[model samples]
Target: MFVDSFSRWMKLYGMRRKSDTLAFVQKFLADMSGTGVPRSFWMDNGGEFVSRDFIAFCDNAGIRRTYTAPGTPQQNGPAESAIWRVNKAGHAARLEAPRLFPKIDFTRVPGFGRDGERLWRESCHWAAGGFNRSPTKANVGRGTCV
Candidate 1:
């Protein structure tokens, strides 16, 4: 499973840096499919999780998609825990490298634009490479499947 956090920043003049919600989902599925299709997925009811594109992808993949009820994150205990861990790690990384924050150009990220347009293909490439190698607590000593 893949997990990550989405952040939104408000701006006064130009378009706001709205969170890139679909990026995570698309990346997650692509990475998982590289190995094999999963039987199902459990997620929260966030806009990203419930998007039409995500639903269609799951349908085409023959993967069952389950959503937790509103305000009841406990229903998706594992996914919630994974998200919390990722958020904590991201926060720590930011603290360690303060300058890295300014380098992230949201407009350049892939699977992030409207209507399935890809912008940040490079970022997606890097993330996929690293994420597929990172060990996970869920898998214990077993490495992640690419």
Candidate 2:
């Protein structure tokens, strides 16, 4: 997940494995078109973020990487704060969805069977979309509804 600090626009990507981060980020940048690559990225020093491929990807794109201090999530600022709200919204959406949608498998609701994790991921994706479209006080005049 990446959030624009000024506008509060968010980009969420669901990955099944750590190795998938680079691809997700690359695709995101490609999809961004005119925005061009970011000057720097703030992220925790997780293995995935520090992986050789990820490092090379950033270097190739001329994106400087900044890592949060170990064991300190607050250093990530807005991105860290937004995560919990995203999760809460997702959980609520998943739980109340049956009531809201009633039928329609509600548009490709995945067959989770016993895989509880995938369900959560799908809900997060759903909520992220809602969040992007829904208006928020912070974004009202700061320039976002993306």
Candidate 3:
């Protein structure tokens, strides 16, 4: 997942391929077409992020690309925190599975709620909402919406 430090907005992904990363950025921009492009895009020193095609795309889009120092995740604390919180939630969800779905046999059914999708979506929303409620300096200069 890629999280915006100031806004606490996140883009979750199932894979981390270079093409997938680029496609995610493109889709996000298309989805928020009129909001204006971000001034810069930050990421870790991952192969997918450093791909030549991705760099070209960002350049063409007029977005500056920034990479965090190797082995220094603290340089991107917001994203790290967001990932931690979501992983913690996932652990809690897994531990609560037996108690919450006692009637369902995991050996056969292997699903939560109506289906697996609902549980995943609910967990994501829960994490994102919690992140959004966290204190941040980004909104201080933006306006009252913070």
The alpha-carbon RMSD values of the candidates against the true structure, listed in the order shown, are: 10.5, 3.3, 4.6
Considering summed lDDT, which 10 consecutive residues are worst modelled in model 3? 109-118
Q: TM-score for model 2? A: 0.80
For residues 51-107, could you state the per-residue lDDT of candidate 1 as single tens digits?
A: 788788789879898888899988877556644544454444434332455575534
lDDT of 3 by residue, 25-127 (tens): 7887886677678888777988877989889999999999888999999988878888888767765665566679889664464445433443565566565
Query: How well does each candidate superpose onto the true structure, as a TM-score?
Result: 0.50, 0.80, 0.72
Order of candidate numbers by lDDT, starting with the best: 2, 3, 1
C-alpha lDDT of residue 87 in model 1? 44
lDDT winner, 1 or 3: 3
Q: Rank the candidates by TM-score, best first.
A: 2, 3, 1
**What lDDT is reached at residue 133 by model 3?**
59
Candidate 2, residue 49: how far the Cα is off, in Å: 1.2
* lDDT of the candidates, in the order given: 0.51, 0.77, 0.70
Cα RMSD, model 3 = 4.6
Clashing pairs in 3: none
Which of candidates 2 and 3 is the stronger one according to TM-score? 2
lDDT of 2 by residue, 2-23 (tens): 8877656788877788878888
Task: At residue 43, give the lDDT of candidate 1.
Answer: 75
Off by over 4 Å in 1: 1-24, 97-146
Best by lDDT: 2
**What's model 3's lDDT at 5?**
62
